[model samples]
Target: MLQDTTSSAPLRSLLFHLSDVELLTRSARQIVEEEAPPCYTLLIFTNGTGRLYIDNQPFLFSPDHCYLLSPGTSLQIENGTDTVVCFYRITFTVIQARDQQQVLYTEDIFPNRYELRVYPLSRLIRLTEQLYAGRLGKGDMEWFKQHLHFQELIGFLLEHNLHSDPSLSLTQSVENTIHYLNHNFMDSITVKQLVQLANVPHWQYTSIFQELTGKKPLDYLTELRINRSKEWLAISNAPLRDIAHRVGFADEYYFNRRFRQTTGVTPRQYAISMRQRVLVKDWTGHEVHIPLQPLRIIYYGETIGDLVTLGIHPIGGNIPNPENRLYKDPTTIIHDVGFPFNTERASALEPDLIIFANSDERQYEQISKIAPTITYNSWATLEERMHILGDWFGKKREAEQWLVHHHNKTKTMWQQLQSSINAGETASVFTYDHGERLFVMGVTGFSTALYHPLGFRPVSKIQDILDAGQGYKEIQESSLPQYAGDRIFMLLPENKISRRAAEDMMNSTLWQSLPAVQSGHVYMAEEAKWNFGDAFTRDKLLEMLPELLQGF
Candidate 1:
């Protein structure tokens, strides 16, 4: 394992040498065996009951336990449950510092052999989930951020069990004083007050505190107060005097001086600059001045799919069908702002950014008052939407990485399917509603993969329809023979009206005469899977395409 010289955090550098991280689920009565692990394994369970045996000693395990499996330790686990047990398992090799071998010595952290430490999973579970989901480690910078989080987790464990390590005995006292300053930062706190609270001599306490945090005690307090004030300045329109008083400054004039010293700007200038909105020309061409890094977003558009792919579950948003598998939970997790977008409900959520697609222009004025509103063209290219959103969320690198990953997946699937399908075979996608609604796969959405290089080609007739700029043209059943390709995908409609219309087409004599139907090449595509084209659905199509192309 190599040292992480990229990061300044020591614990982060320690975790940079990770071997693997994964989420595992065990069924009821499942028995698992173990050999001596090659690396340290950290198992964080968020649910279910289980038992682990180490050296034939049984340890009762349940939710919120962070178990540490040291190297060369063997264990067995059994889930004694009627329900499934899910846990996140992380395996990493700890690199010992050549000069500071005493720091994070395996023996010092674990204390007992094969010790299964218990830790609270409040924030750790989300971090582990993010790491396992491919949402956190997309690039070098993203991985560094994740390393910092891992460092925080290690620091948390050390904070909880410092009694076992004598080398960090003074860290315990400094941590106590730090906790006091954090809570009392808004109060008139002093260096003497914190030293008195730590029950240590002024000089000794100052030295140890500086050694741990790399800042003087009063400097730390001042930094904390200024940081808190910055948040208020960004989010609130409160007066300077009130904001200054709230963050422990008795006088507005003194706060102005300190804020300028720390931030290189006057407090008033900082507030104005911090809350300054960023302007973006949306697909609708309307300039939207959106707040930076909006924590509360309301998505009222074609799909919430992009937000999810970017790992942002907006505070409130319009949801797709409850049965839409692409969206993890349309009913439970997302607060539904009704389709026509209940303006009152959206306002109630108090979103910092409101994004929608093709909404009535009349509603923009009202919606803008609730928050900075931006509109997107639902039919625009996926790359276009992703670029706009990546800029909005400051995830431009992740967005680009996903595009590259998606492109590779599409290319790979194309190669795999080519081996199973006829050369130059054409495919057409459409749905039967009141009538035949024929769609030509474009460069975006489902079309990106369907018509990607070496993928399926559209029939000459449908190609003309696409060339004519009518995205999805509605043609009669009589024209099926001319437009239907060698292979076809018929998206099943969800509404009863459309289902009945589709049934009529399925029974029509003209439909059976089509080459795809006659040759058994017409497949019923899942609506939830094919309807909206987002990154998640596109990735899923990669997995499903090869199997669907088999024997065709």
Candidate 2:
């Protein structure tokens, strides 16, 4: 029997080393990647469409499609489309394979193979972000946990046909059935329906599905419904019956019984417990028990704007003391946690909950000792982070409402600005980081929101920079005209070095000759407010953007 390697049958050491992983964004017509060393590679396309060549074999790839290549494989991806293509690549090696037969048997899983499969990017994207950000520490315990996460990822791929034989008709049939179940889990599903979809006998369909996924077809459907129900239970105030029906259960009583059987807790108990305190899994993948409605909270992260938007004012946070207060109408009494955050002072605030960015991981342990701490990826997209915060705070409705309002406001403002600004007019954002370090912002902070759908378009050069996934490009003052667009928003960083650079730029003839400058389309932006992509910052941008875009 070819047993499923992902199943629990462990022995001996299985050492692994991760070479690199990244979410690459590209807009160039032709982009080629070459590596000196031969290793296993995995690619997941999340945006746009492109043709990828593994060696000489071409595979037409698009969003939600995944590719796995064996050792010594070479890749040449081409994006002929005008839209930007974004994909994630992960490279790693298995140094010491387990000596056991089960482990050794799966060693040649993708041998001489360039396999394309279907795997949802949502699950894999979060894991890739965690690994890329180093939120999982380098400690032995953390390493073990990271390895488990990798195993889970691999298991997901395998379940979808990473190791399945293409010649086997039953394999494809089982896969289709699984896909059907996944997409229609909210509808009443039965063995007869699944078997009909698989186009196979009831017994045969169940047998192959169990062999491939290690779960019976009906059992798999139940698990999917239960998992989705857990998400709704944590984030919504929906009643038990409504929640049960939402996840495909015919009755609330049956849903309660099945939920208890699977999770060892009833639906109502789970909801009540979560209402008091819930176990939150953050970007680090750590399940930390936190208060559902925290009274006193502090955060040592750049998402103060997001916290403020949620209407839960933090007792203390890493609020910047900028020379110019960007957003006025300040009502929350905030205790500054100091630069890099003063742990001792943070403790003095008597906060019951603490939040930090995954980037600021060094302070996690020390700060965690004072209060329960959770970390979020500060670098993720604005929508991604906002939805995550909304889920954690059980304010999804509020988040959705704010987004709707922002969308309406942005639409109206764009319509109004069209009178002065041409339809194809371009914009660019620049910031003075320090002495001689001039950065052109890409898809982050204010730049991201500014270049959103129906918003101003970026210049070709800046668009290429963004497509290449460069957060900010450092450029010389003399090169400003090349990157500057019809309109420019220049951020003034609050530092002596930046002050010196700003003085130098102000004195330069190169700065005065730019098209945007000649037309008086250049505006000064407060660094703190313009550089952050949080809800508060976004709202502030909404309030100020029309004024900035007025009169062309």
Off by over 4 Å in 1: 1-276, 326-332, 434-445, 468-470
Write down the lDDT of every candidate, Cα atoms only. 0.66, 0.69
Cα lDDT for residue 346, model 2? Answer: 85
Q: For residues 1-552, write the lDDT of model 2, one tens digit per residue.
A: 112223222223544456676656665466667562466677876555556777776555555557776667667887765435666688777554544432322244544445445345445544554454332244687576566666666667656554455435455556656755654688878898777765677777788899978998778888989976875676568888998999999999999999999999997777667657789998887689888877678877766777777676776777553211322222234566778778888877667688888545567888888888998877677677778889998999888888788778778877766677777778888888756688998876678767855667898889998888667888887788889989888776656688568757855898888888888887665574467777777776675677556611
lDDT of 2 at 172: 50
Evaluated with lDDT, which candidate comes out highest? Answer: 2
Tell me model 2's lDDT, rounded to 2 decimals: 0.69
lDDT of 1 by residue, 1-552 (tens): 001122222443353356677656676679888676767778776555556776465554555556677776677888754435667778776765656453332432344423333244434554564355332244688577566656656666555553343323344445556755654578888788776665566887889898877999988888988976876776677788999999999988999999999999987787677565777887667887887656567887655677778887676776544324443321113456777779988887657788877647888777888888998766666787788789877789988988888778777777866666777888887775443453444334455457655877877886776576444666776776777888877776655567566667777898888878988887665453466677677776676666556621
Give the count of colliding residue pairs in each prediction.
Answer: 0, 0
Which residue pairs come into collision in candidate 1?
Answer: none
Which run of 10 residues does model 2 get worst, by summed lDDT? 1-10
